[model samples]
Target: MRRKVRNYILIVISMVTGTVSFAQTEIENPFGLVYRDAITENLPGKVNIQPVTYTLNGIEIAANVYTPANYDPDKKFPAIVVAHPNGGVKEQVAGLYAQLLAEQGYISITADAAYQGASGGTPRNVDIPHNRIEDIHGMADFIIQYEGVDSERIGLLGICGGGGYSLKAAQSDKRFRAVATLSMFNSGVVRRNGFRNSQVNTIQERLKKASDARAQEAAGGEVIYAADNAIPTEEAELAKIPYDLYREGYIYYGNTHKHPNSTFRYTMSSLLYLMTFDASTNMNLINQPLLMMAGSKADTYYMTDEAYRKVTNAKDKELFLIESATHIQTYYVPEYVSQAMEKLNVFFGKYINSEA
Candidate 1:
């Protein structure tokens, strides 16, 4: 199974080199992304999307704000900040959930992390856990002041890696009235131990490599990074295991739902910081209402389960699972998404409506 995965990764490398040719075809302006509620020209209804930008730590952060139907600035409305996955941007699952939440009568916003996607940051795709958590705080800083957003009623929803960071952000940032995560991925754990500890023995070796990468950068050497930079069509046909999130993720991010800015790689030097962070270390600090949803069948389920167990301070918490959905499946599968959003609507509605 690992060999099959590795071979496909090689294909991604080749495709990245020839990205220009592949991009010209099916991949158009925003890149060939076809998820529901995706922002096209203009959405007609009680929900609408607007491109917005704000500065975070002196860097420009790109974001999309989804407003409820017939939005009125004179009136106040609850708000929710949606954080995208690790290899995702605000235009993918994060945007979908944001739009859905907007349709449910809350102002929703999703943003590209400072160093990833369209956001501004030097040395792209750094994937530092602290920066990610700060991005969530930055979103809160911006959205709490948005027109029509009721400061006391703001909520948060983080998907995948963003989910992990959200937990960390909520630890100290009491601004969020409620917190929720879907398909929560512990970025620190996965980075340090590999998926399910498959590479646990290589922890020190990887750390040394990351240290070397940082030193090389300090020496003014060419920036060294890591990522699956290519997407090959042929690899999709090879026999693969069912419910493999990475396999489905490659197809989703690289092919069908491809976004030019989304790639599954980060600076090799980032591991030095990533390996030392833990999203759940201060989990008890998140005293707000918490809702964590994950696919029961997802191999990444353990991360969510463990983190959920450590969240002993949340006033209320629930680990809702979509019975058969895989990790990536929760991102785009209509049925699963609908299920997750339905839960979120209730979760946010109940908590965001209640005040201190």
Candidate 2:
């Protein structure tokens, strides 16, 4: 199974090198390098987003915490721990959301998933199904230990892959009072298939790649990875949108996005774990305060709806749709972000603030 996963990764690498081009097309991202309305425009708080490290599963994980200017250490405040997407680090959209959420007086921490970003881990981006789940718990643990954090008032906000983990965390651990995901990706399903299950047609072809990857690894060939957003020239209109997001993701996390040592991609082995993992497998088990938000126009809209229907035990659940906001726009747009923050503050306030 591992070998099969590795071979799928090789295909990603091959595409990057143009050895085997999937689509000989290059699409431009509408968000592009210059977004006119930046976060600085909306962030009026004394934002103190700083880097910190904490031990998790014996690994010293790296993270950044965004404390709103409204923060008052004299009063222990509620905190929201944010998780990045698969193949993403602390600085991507996750951090952006964290900072915005912080401006509302919630302490938010965005961390490097194990084996990615500046955190200490070997076999980078290996994509172990279990490790990602544990990373959520690790962040939870870090927040509670902080001197000024109101441990019982803690909530979680996960973006993409991080979103799946948040749901998993609330299901298994009773610690989080609430959980939310933005443009959540069922990392497992996406990897096993492709965008909208487009690559799920042939099992034989997949198996062959697995066998080939095992052989290639045995030969000590360097592992290759898929470059973000290399949609074929012939891809459908919807597919082109995600490709644009990938391109924008690279720019945000790769360059303009702050926090040093972060990256937009992970190791090739991450492909192996991703192929078999699915957070939706036990959706009915999560029973907590749940807020599932997505752009009305996102490719990932189905997963959010699917997850919302399955969590049989959730005490309170709400599905929010942002009008005109696509998956990528929600990541960087202040108008969309402010709307999300407003909803989130209301949700967290019902749970976290009401208690005080």
Best by TM-score: 1
**10 residues in a row with least lDDT, candidate 1:** 1-10
Residues 85-139, candidate 2: write the lDDT tens digits: 7766665577667777776788888788777777878655556668888988898
For candidate 1, write residues 246-282 as lDDT tens digits: 7667767876567778988899999999999887787
Off by over 4 Å in 2: 1-45, 202-204, 207-264
lDDT of 2: 0.69
| Per-model TM-score versus the true fold | 0.89, 0.78
Write down the worst ten-residue block by lDDT for model 2. Answer: 1-10
Which regions of candidate 1 fall more than 4 Å away from where they truly are?
1-34, 43-45, 235-243, 354-356
RMSD of each: 7.5, 9.9
User: After TM-score superposition, what is the CA distance of residue 135 in candidate 1 from its true location, in Å?
Assistant: 0.5
What's the residue-level lDDT of 201 in candidate 2?
Answer: 86
